[model samples]
Target: MNDQPLSGLTVIDFSTLLPGPLATLMLAEAGATVIKIERPGGEDMRFFPPKSGDVGTLYAMLNRGKRCLELDLKAADARARILELTDAADIVVEQFRPGVMARLGLGADELCARNPRLIHCSITGFGQSGPRAMEAGHDLNYMALTGLLALSRGSFDAPVLPPAQFADIGGGSFPAVINILLALLQRDRTGKGSRLDIAMCDAMFTFALFAQAQLTTLGHAPKNGADLLTGASPRYRLYPAADGHLIAVGALEDKFWQALCDAVELPDLHRDDRRDSEACAAAMAERIASRTAAEWVPVLAGADCCATPLATLEDAFRDPHFLERGLFDFTADADDTPIPATIVPIDRAFRGRAGAIDPD
Candidate 1:
């Protein structure tokens, strides 16, 4: 039996950066034949810094297991080639502005009309028909517009920039992949296909579920840093050790909280954090700062508390747990050298071979 779910499917990807490329990458990993179409000089991401030989590491990581084709889409011959490819494709993913593809005669309407069974997905910041559809924006702008950034402000002076592109991957790529799969399933049932407009901003509102609940109950959401999960409670915040390393505390339940309090030897007066949350947090912070992360590791290890020392990227890459799980088993080739492939959330049973690289 075939392990790859999308074994015989074909995907034509016109996405330049993270969202579209990532969606197609997931499809490719699931055994789809993904053909990435780039402009003459290739996409802007190809020129991004930190290159591996001639290709950018970011671009190589995302575009692994996909075929490449360069074409000037504005030219007549290019449009003809795309239409021909659309005739045989199962899915087409694009991340252009609202009317850009339409102006180039490569819009979903034109392509779907030709194939009638193509699952066309368009990923954009705002959407296809909204007033802001034509406006230029990135991941940060999408988060800011969706009120997600306001929930976890860093300080009064400036808001914190997220370490990852939540809106781009969570909102855009994930939704696009999910809907494309759904569309494919639906097409199997009814001999027809559909167009999906995946607005990155529209999906980010779901990430604000906690804030929305507070807003519904109290007519307004809690201010930044005041929410229970956002540093208000000592049980669910990051505490710094004497060595300046941070420990992520997630002892939300009573049992875990009690375990954490006992392990840290927190005072009885500050144990009942409900009485004075700020004072309790301050006391806990003081205790955590008294010892270095290394000294506290063994004490917290057997406590059964959810607290853990924050691991840097380098540390995480070398973590024994992840290595035992074979998270980096697969490798993508860059300059003919094998680099660890970006691991997606697909089950190993449904993914491609562990050591397989994309064929040229």
Candidate 2:
């Protein structure tokens, strides 16, 4: 039996940066042949900081296991070449503005008309037919527009950008992958393909489900930084240790909260009232600051509270749980150098234990 689910699939990727690339990367890891089509000087991400040799580290990491071909889409011959490639391709993933692909004569309508079975996925900030569809934006802009950024704001006036690109990966990439796979499954049954319009901003609204419920059901709009999951509850928050390291505390349930209070010897902080959240948070913060993260992590673990010390990127790559699962065990490049990578979140039985790397 074949371990790779998408072993026979071919993906024509015309995306740069994170969202689209990440979706295709997951497809590539699932055994799809991803052919990345680049422009004249390559994608903008290739010039980003932190270079590995001449290539950007981020680009190198995301584009691994994919074949690259340069094409000047503005040129007639180049556009002809894309149509030729589309004739034999199973999927086409693009991240251009609303009308850009149509102007270039490579839109879903044109391609899908040629190859009736082609799955075309377009990832954009707003959507295909919205007022802001053609507007220039990025991950932060999407989050802000979709009301996700308000939930992540600090106590101060200035909004804090999330540590990761929430919209790009969460809204854009994951949705594209899910819908593409669904489209493929549907194609199998009907022998016809469909177009996927993945709007990052539109997708982000789903992440605000709880907040939306509060507004519609209870007629209460959640305040910035004061929602249940947004630091309004003491049980679910991050505490700073004496060593300046942050320890995440997720003792949300009654039992876990009690366990954390007992373990930290702050039984008074186990409050069930929203009115007491601020005081409880302050008390917990003070208590947590009395000990180092290394000292508190084990004690919290002993109590069975869902508490843990925050791991840096370096520490996370070396974490035992991931290591035991063989998530970082990737295939080496042509130079025989191991390219570190993360595993797609899937059933362990279906995953390839080794990493996928591009040739040197």
Candidate 3:
């Protein structure tokens, strides 16, 4: 028997792409029954590259625990079927340009009328009602409007993409999950549902917590690489090693910085805060490059600098620490196919071996 947090909850998912799917995926992970509605063919990510045979690893990963029903919403019969299904759903997640749902007769106003207690959530690129609501966009475009794109280094002139999709997953997916859960809690009191409109552009804007803080307190937006955590301080940044590997340093506190300087035998830099920070940064880089990453790993690990060697994504899987924490495990497909997956973070006792969960 399996025990999960959302054992009997039912989610009727009409959303596609990353944010909506990822939100429902997390719900599914916790044993919610998520019915994945697909087109006659499949999802857009099916065309995504890096496939494992015929199935896209991307699709399989995001949509593992859901049942897919192929339907062409434009067809009258299929639309009716979808409406019927919605009546029995606890939640409906749809991500589309605004008016698409209303055109399909699945608009929130009517959906709630069909089922008085259904939580109807709409995930959109801009929003249901906004100037940019109809504009097409991807992850990068989402961050651009949110000002998160400004945090990373631009080409001495232009903004660059950050390492991850801050807007799509962080803002949109996480917020949708949070609100839906909150709605569920509220429903217990009001015995009514809600209509949630999640705008990717607006959602991502909230992710710029520190960046916005600078604007509010400092009177202007922070420039590229000019903020405290964005390589502005030598204490909290990456340094190249002698062998081209990287050392991640986060010695922000005076005590930690002192420990870092002592570990490196560079007492001169212990308290020199007003020096030409650029020159100091370059000099520190060279000093770091004088030793191999492996050589300095133990040295820094012994220090109070909160420092460590930068790790490659693949290398992270083999890292003894993650393994010990049960971050990965084997799962079987319906046809008895074995699949490798990483465990989402949660208290250990709340999950089965390899992070298997059943809300029971």
Q: lDDT of each structure?
A: 0.89, 0.84, 0.78
Instruction: Give me the overall lDDT of model 2.
Output: 0.84
- Which stretches in model 3 have alpha-carbon errors above 4 Å? 157-159, 274-276, 330-337, 346-360
lDDT of 3 by residue, 164-272 (tens): 7777887788889889989999998999999999988887767777888989998897887887788788888899998989999888888997787778776485346
Please provide, for model 2 over 245-353, each residue's C-alpha lDDT reduced to its tens digit, 9 standing for 90 to 100: 9999888888998888888888563454466777778888888999999999789889998999999989988899988977777542423445566456656555544
Best by lDDT: 1
Q: Please give the range of 10 consecutive residues that has the lowest summed lDDT in model 3.
A: 351-360
> Could you tell me the TM-score of candidate 3?
0.92
In model 2, state the lDDT of residue 252: 87
Better of 1 and 3 by TM-score: 1
TM-score of each: 0.96, 0.92, 0.92
Given candidate 3, what's the lDDT at residue 186? 92
Task: Give the clashing pairs for model 2.
Answer: 330-355, 331-355
Residue 160 in model 2: shift from native, Å?
1.5
Please report how far candidate 3 places residue 204 from its true position, in Å: 2.3
